[model samples]
Target: MTTQENVRRVLDWAVAEIGVPGIVAEVKDGDQTWFASAGVADIRTGAARRPGEYLHTGSSGKAFTAAVLLSLEAEGRLSLEDTVNTRLPGVLGTNGYDGDKITIRHLLSNTGGLFPTGLAPEVSHRYATRSGILEHRFDTFTTEELLRIAVSQPPVGAPGDRFEYANGGFHLAGAIIEKITGNTYAEEVDRRVIQPLGLTHTRVRPLDDTGYPAPHPRAYSTLFLKDGADPSTVTPENWESLMEEPGQPPLDVTEFNTSLAWSAGNVVSTTGDMIHFVDSMVTGSLLPPAQHRQLWTTVSTEGSYWMPHARYGLGMFEFDKQATGGRTLRGVGGSLWGTWFLAVGTPDDQHTIAVHTNTEWKSWDLMFKLIEAEFGVAIGA
Candidate 1:
């Protein structure tokens, strides 16, 4: 029952009220599919946003990663119960951690206790601010470098103790995928998920900075910079002040290397592909019955500093949107340097909505508003 008019209002509000530069959304309800956008894709050119524009979907790619690994389990190539040490011997037994104690299940469910090293204050100070992102934006990072950075930090919690978001866990998953299949994580994802679903617009973990496709909106970063201060440490009051100051346009962060995120957060895809991908997942077309159940098996994310009030599943989440008529929706969501994305579908596979903004900041409510508009649900907005 999603109409174009409803979507248009939400998109307009996002531009007029939230100032995303541009936003794109796709909603599918049974045989009816609706696509719309508001604001200009390029602030300078004033170009209109298009449905076909490519989106770097960030950790939303985790669903694809989980699907690939779970598909391998369905094929008897692996088991969710397998320990990390059993797969990749010595990669994770560092910094007050025991690799033998962590299971593939724990990693997928966001309970592996791996620290998100990319979010470290020092790392952010060097590469997350407006100017900091420039120095090494084009640098291609190897998996070894990524792992070394991640495990250098102490474990946040014991494996299976709590729901703590960890991007490094997915890298561990990617390493296991390569070890078991003798194929790159990207290759396995291609053969198992992308090729099967005919998702032509999706590519995971780009190899270089040159891979960012054209005909896409220029990404803008709201990570404000001032003197030598890191943007990651910006408090709410100061961030508000920075936003209210005039003549401050967001930085164009479109050209950075996606390999900095590797298999964890770097899947560039489109809304069209995402809507279809989530639909396929809900219909159990991606994994066998046993494996699909494993994928949907829930672990409470109560104390999670990331995505609170949701239940973590295998690389995805089930959100009980009290603001959206208390309906429970299943999907994967993620944010990158300059994007906030949410791709959700009804549990029965009757409807799906995929939406994302060009900037990572100032997107909290705008995202749920997109869904509220399409599904005619109430927003606490």
Candidate 2:
């Protein structure tokens, strides 16, 4: 069977079994590329999802922020060993936070012990619960506000102490990028990665911008309801309640202002663009030798907010023989509202898979199924 057909089978199963609104999977192996989708983009119109449509990529944008910083480092604009205080002194040291103790490398790998801002349960619950998203959906927030929210909470650990997945680290990274380059995080990313690579379809959603570019799927999200009240109890009328269930028909989040996610999770792109981006990242074509090697240097994340045996590098995850049986997979995975996207490939850049689902409620089986179907490699067996 063709790879497209095979991926369609999996997408079909994901829709039927997981009850998601839609799914899109793109595979790039050598010279061949496959794009497959199942389910609908709009529930009211029952519009079919198309291949070229962009979706909210959530924290996958973390990789972009990391790349921009690494590029700056390559030009001797900064150093990974530079402590946060050296560049943006006193910005993150308030409330028991010591910026001097946290290195850029620690921040990139999420070991800087800074409290998480966007990923904090309280921030997540605030939007998904009592207020729902309507109140804040259009609100624009500054990156420094996000940093303040994170530092208000006690530090999670000492610098380089643990492998917690914190969006605050990337936010800090973005802030530093701004300090050094005098350009916005999105601007740097565009100049360094998107424009250079000719990724015409990739874009960083602006803080004040709502809605997507033309020919994009409407994103849906239930925010952090997944860990709350039972799904069956959730009804359309009370969907905005704090006790609201997790997976009621997802609300249309397509046009929500992405500023709340800042430099951490506000990228939109197509599978084709993602494939090329992943290929570039895995091959070190966009990074200098020193930065490239630093990108792969990792620390154990087995007990962090990731799968078993997973290791974290600067801004991506590394799954090697232990995590992926015998092969290696390095990439980023992100979810926001009701959408999810994951892009991973081997160290040698021989194979790559980029998959997106319109609903974030799918189970872990979806990942293993995709890997097994695409690469014939059983992960977590």
Worst 10 residues of 1 by lDDT: 236-245
Model 2 lDDT per residue over 303-353, tens place: 554556578888887875675777878888888776799998875745899
Alpha-carbon RMSD of each model: 2.8, 4.3
Deviation from native of the Cα of residue 11 in model 1, angstroms: 1.2
Name the lDDT value of residue 227 in candidate 2. Answer: 48
- Residue lDDT tens for model 1, 145-231: 777776777888899998888878887888889999998989989999999999998888557654467678888876555655555
> TM-score of the candidate numbered 2?
0.91
Deviating ranges (above 4 Å) for candidate 1: 1-3, 230-247, 321-326, 379-381
